[model samples]
Structures are given as C-alpha cells and as structure tokens.
Target: MEKHGLRERKKQRTRHALIEAAVRLFEDQGYDQVTVAEIADAAEVSPRTFFLHFPAKEDVLLADADLRVDLALRAIAERDPAEPLAGVLVRAMDQMIAHAWDSDLPTGLAALRARLAASVPALQARLLQRYLTAQADLAQALLRAFPGRLDAITASALVGAMVGAVGAAALTALRRGDGPDEVRDAMRQATALVARSVT
Candidate 1:
C-alpha cells in the first residue's frame, strides 16, 4: 500500500510539473509558439512522458475542467436522493472550488488558460467541445441519481444552464482581470441564480 501510494504521488508530481511548465511557457512565449518538446524539457521530462499525461498541448489548459467534471459526477452520485437537483449542482460547484483551492496548481492557471483559449481559435473550439461533453456527462449522472424524477430533456437543460452560467461568469471575471477568488465568487453567484431559477 505504501509503495502504491508513493507511485501515485510521483505520478502526480510529474503531472503537476508538466502543467506548471506548460502554463509558464505558454504565458511567456504564447501558446502557439510553445512545442511539446519545449514543455517536456521545461518540466524535466521526455516528450513521451508528457504524452502519457496529456494527449496534446491544448489538453493542458483543459485538464482542470476535465477533472472537475469527474468530481461533479462523483458529487452527484454521493448526494442525498431527496435533495433538489439544483442544490446538488451547487454543492458540486462548491466542491470543485474547494478542490481547486486545495490543489497544488498555481492559483491563476485557470484564468490564464481561459485567456489563452479565448485568443486561440483551436483552443476555443476544444473548450466548447469539452463543455458539451461535460454537460452530457453531468446530465446523465443527474438522471441516474434522480431516477424517474427527470427526463433526458429536462436533465440536459438543467445541466446546460448550470454549465453555461458558470462558464460565462468565470469568463467575464477573467476578462475583467479579477483574481481567482473573484472569479470563483462570480461563478458562485451565477450558480446561485441558476439554482434559484430552477427551484
């Protein structure tokens, strides 16, 4: 068990290192100018090692979003069945925020990534695609949790509203040069509005 734990920790370190190096390089040199080899070199890892963690350079900017989706699904699964769907979603968002705060990642990384994505057409497309995928995943998970209480359409709409509201708020905050706490506060406010509208 100790050996397994150690291995997991080592892998996490490598992944974190890669992300930090990529974000710094992207910020300093621009995302399009940074190569996978350069990111790997900055992280003190081989290109193959970088590939093992992320399929492409764009994936680095999106890694946190993907993780949050997984976290939200888990939160939905573990939520009280009697709780309202909107409340569960709000809780999930809170969980994601808490996790982000506790993570070893740099505080401004998400905002930086958002800025980069907005400037890069390819990254913008990728971000939209991931958002759709995450919305579907969250909707399916919500349906499973609530059983017969929700139809697919309703589930989709609820998930879409939550994702869209949060995304818009976060983007606005980032564009306005708000720091991480302000960005999170903006998201929380948007989430609360969505939850109230649904309830």
Candidate 2:
C-alpha cells in the first residue's frame, strides 16, 4: 500500500508538471503552434508521459472543467436528502459556479477556449462531450441518491437540463462581456432557472 501510494503520488506530480508545461508553452506560443514533443521537453518528461496525463492537447487547457464532474456528484450527495433532486442540483451548481469564480482562471484560458472552438472542430466536439459525460455522471448520482424512485430517462433529462442551463448562462455572460460580477450574475440566473423547475 505504501508503494502504491508513492507510485500514485509520483504519477500525479509528473502529470501536473506536464500540464503546467503545456499551459506555459501554449500561452507563450499559442496552442496550435505548440506540439506534444515540445510540451514533453518543456516538462522534462517523455512524450509518452504527456499522453498519459492528457488524451489530447486541448484537454490540457480544459482538465479543470472535467474534474468538476466528480465534484458535482459529491456536492449532490452532500445535500439534504429531504430536498428534491432539482434543489440538490441547484445547490451543487451553486457550489460549482462559486468554485469556478474563485479559481481565477487566467484570462487566456477563456481566450484560448474561444480560439480553439473557432479553429478546431474537434475541440468543440470534445467540449460538448465533456458536458454530456457530466450529465450522465450527475444522472447516475441522482439515481443512486433516490434509489428506485427515479427512472433513468427522467434523471438524465433533469441532469441534462441543469447542465445545459449552467452552460447557457456561462456562454451568455461570456458573450456579453468579461467580469466576475457578470459571471456571478449569470450563475445566479442559471441556478434560479434550475430552482424554479424543482418539485
């Protein structure tokens, strides 16, 4: 167990180094111009190590977004069981949006995402896929939370709607302008939308 823990810690350190290197290189040279080989060299790791940390280049920039899915599930599980699922989801999203707002993600993160979406169809598809996966995860959590009370389709739709509302609010805020205040307002609106649908 000790050896396994050490191995896991080493793996995590290596992955973090790779992600940091990739982000620095991407920020300096722009994402399209920075190759995996260059990122590996910058991180002082093998190209294979870079691949182990991330499936593709764009994922380097979006890894935090993916990590939030599990966090959302945990948040739901922590909510009052007496509350309706929709209420729980709204609370989960509130926690999530608050966390994101606090993360202080580099301005370049949003700029890079916009650039990638415009320049690469695959990245756009992957972003959509991430949201879809998050929905499925949340749905499964809701299923387990409610036991046999909720059907899969209903759970899926509920999760989908909640995720979609948050995404829409975020995109709307981004399109309007940039500022934490705007982002917070958008989150509030999004959560309100979900809240209204509950029970």
Measured by TM-score, the strongest candidate is 1
Best by lDDT: 1
Error of 2 at 8 (Å): 7.6
Residue 157 error for model 2, in Å?
1.8
lDDT of 2: 0.76
TM-score of predicted structure 2: 0.78
Which residue pairs overlap in candidate 2's backbone? none
The local distance difference test score of each candidate is 0.84, 0.76
| Candidate 1 lDDT over residue span 53-160, tens digit each | 998889988777777778888999999867887789898777776666555224567778777876899888888899889889999998899888889999999988
